[model samples]
Target: MEHINQVIEQLNLEASLTLEEIPQIDLYMDQVIQLFENKFTESKRNEDDKVLTKTMINNYAKGKLIFPIQNKKYSKEHLILMSLIYQLKGALSINDIKATLTGMNQKIIKEEIDLDSFYTSYLNLTRQNVEDFKVDLEDSVKDVNEEITGDKKGDSPYLKQVLMISSLVHMSNLYRRVAEKLVDEITVEKEEKRHK
Candidate 1:
């Protein structure tokens, strides 16, 4: 329980810069990398791990996962796009991310929405959902722990840990599936619109 609480505390302390926290001025590639590294320090597992790399950034631009840099300077919108890709890459495929970004770019290009507006809305919703997930995870962990403690069969600590991990993995898998479904839906919608 102490360990669980500590983990939760660490998670609660983990911070990502809000859309408003990102600078509006255009930044050079090195500056962009440094900014992401500072903001996402917790995400790196080791000192040697790169948070954002120049090669990855170049690939993202070339692949159209993010907007093209102008005069080797990335704008706030580019930062926002890269941030989203960084967060999603762990759970989503590059194709799915690209499709979603394409839809967003379409809206932005059409003047139906602005990048700042979209990013602000995304940040607000994501922050709320992250808070809710934290609460849910804490409650689930406590409930699992209590159940293990109350078991007369004398479950071992290993068993308890296994059960807790399994439950969390199941929940994570569900979220991943839902995200895939959403990507598919968005992609199809975009395709249909393009044809019309």
Candidate 2:
């Protein structure tokens, strides 16, 4: 249970992380259900929506939880986004989130994604990398900053996400590189034989 929330916050399905490319969203939604199973799908009785509202939301919206004119209740999606807002805090901007969502929507429309598989394993793996990357990411960011002045400030959310999967992708490609080198060598040797 403790590790569940840890997976959500630590998991990095960076913006470039297309659903088509990855297995799942770190199984976040499933973790949420498991975390509060008694409160949600498994509960014998229903609970009021009011309990979902919290003072923290006001702070997240910069101290303004405007009661919507279209009935004053919050849905799970809103709560989830708000929770992200809180987690991301100063690291990401509202505009960034909007753009990300818009991009995600476009991907869904463009590429009929089948979002059925559980990504808990990927999520847990990502979470582990994020922890491991703390110092490495900071150092790399610093070096990158030194290279470019006024570089849109701290922790490029873009890079943060890239560092994780790119590392894995590159690692996977290492074998490809070796295979390619072997093939090149074989071709060269065969060509030499033909020439002789």
Candidate 3:
């Protein structure tokens, strides 16, 4: 188990494994299964999401998930993006998250996501717009009704406060899938052009 962990230590997400190392995945997976069996603890899945989120933020900020190995090295950039998928917390499988995050990292590599301008713009808008939306929604609701309704009230602007975050999460997932195909197309085109 220690050997398996050592081999993975500091290896980037896209790190190449030798032919000799290829067959060891089965052995490592067996260890994983044994570890899971020995330490079975039941908790809400969302708790894992919280743990993932905290781990990702810390790792990304610090630029690595696990500590450096003696010689082996993993990609810090790769794991920073992995943090986002960690919050997803296995609602999606490890393979699924890896595929999705890989595409996102490619997008970042290609300048599809402009880090400084994008987050700065988003944060500024989110800060002001969130309060505006909430205040306006409350005032509108108070003007219209003095009491609570039994219905879902899904139509209200107030619903945006509760649902928009989840809706964005869903939309982000949808867009990531769509974007992955585009990445495939771009990769193919680049390969074809290179051969010519």
Candidate 4:
């Protein structure tokens, strides 16, 4: 329990770089990896965890999940796209991620919003929700713990932990499904507007 509390505290302290904080100058692949490693050092759970990798970046480009690099250098837009890919890869397939990003990429290409502005808006929106999300997560964990404790069926502690994890996984999957649907709908709506 103490360890769990400590982890939560650490998570609350962790912060991603804001749009303005990201480097404005273009970076080569190795530089991009180094930058991410430095920026995300505090957030890494273990030495084995990857921050970013050359192969991953190349794979993303090959998969069309991100825009093509220019002169083998990544711009701020590429950094933003890489960040999104890193976060989304946990719960979404590469194809799904590509579908979700395609609309935004089109908007960027059309000068609807620059990369910095797009990332800034995303940061603002997520920052607004961060506290609320923390509260909700704490509440959910407490509720699960209380419910498990109240049960008198003599379930083992390990089983209780498994049950808690399963419940959380289910909730995460549901959220991901909803998010995918929402992204698809938004993309369709944008396409309709473009064609009209």
Give the number of the best model, judged by lDDT.
1
Local lDDT at 97 for model 4: 88
TM-score, each model?
Answer: 0.88, 0.27, 0.29, 0.84
Residue-pair clashes, model 3: 6
What is candidate 1's lDDT per residue for 1-196, written digit by digit as tens? 4377667665544466677678879999999999989887776667798989999998898888876678999888788889889888879988888987886666655768777777777778877887897788789878887888899585677877888899999988999999999999998887898899
Model 3: residues with Cα > 4 Å off, grouped in runs: 1-103, 111-113, 140-144, 147-196
Sort by TM-score, top down from the best:
1, 4, 3, 2
Per-residue lDDT of 185 in model 3 = 67
Rank order (by lDDT, best first) = 1, 4, 3, 2
Which residue segments of model 2 deviate by more than 4 Å?
1-70, 103-126, 134-196
Runs with alpha carbons beyond 4 Å of true place in candidate 1: 12-14
Backbone clash pairs for candidate 1 read none
153-182: candidate 3 lDDT, tens digit per residue: 554556543454454466568856676676
Each candidate's root-mean-square deviation in Å?
2.1, 18.9, 15.7, 2.7
Clashing pairs in 4: none
Instruction: Give model 1's TM-score versus the native structure.
Output: 0.88
Candidate 4 minimal-lDDT segment of 10 residues: 1-10
The CA lDDT of each predicted structure is 0.81, 0.40, 0.41, 0.77
- Clash count, one per candidate: 0, 0, 6, 0
Query: Which tens-of-lDDT digit does each residue in 1-196 have in candidate 4?
Result: 2245566667643466667667889999999999888887777777798888888898998988877789999988888888878778878888788888887777766868777776777777767777776677677667767777788774457756677678778888998999889878876886898899
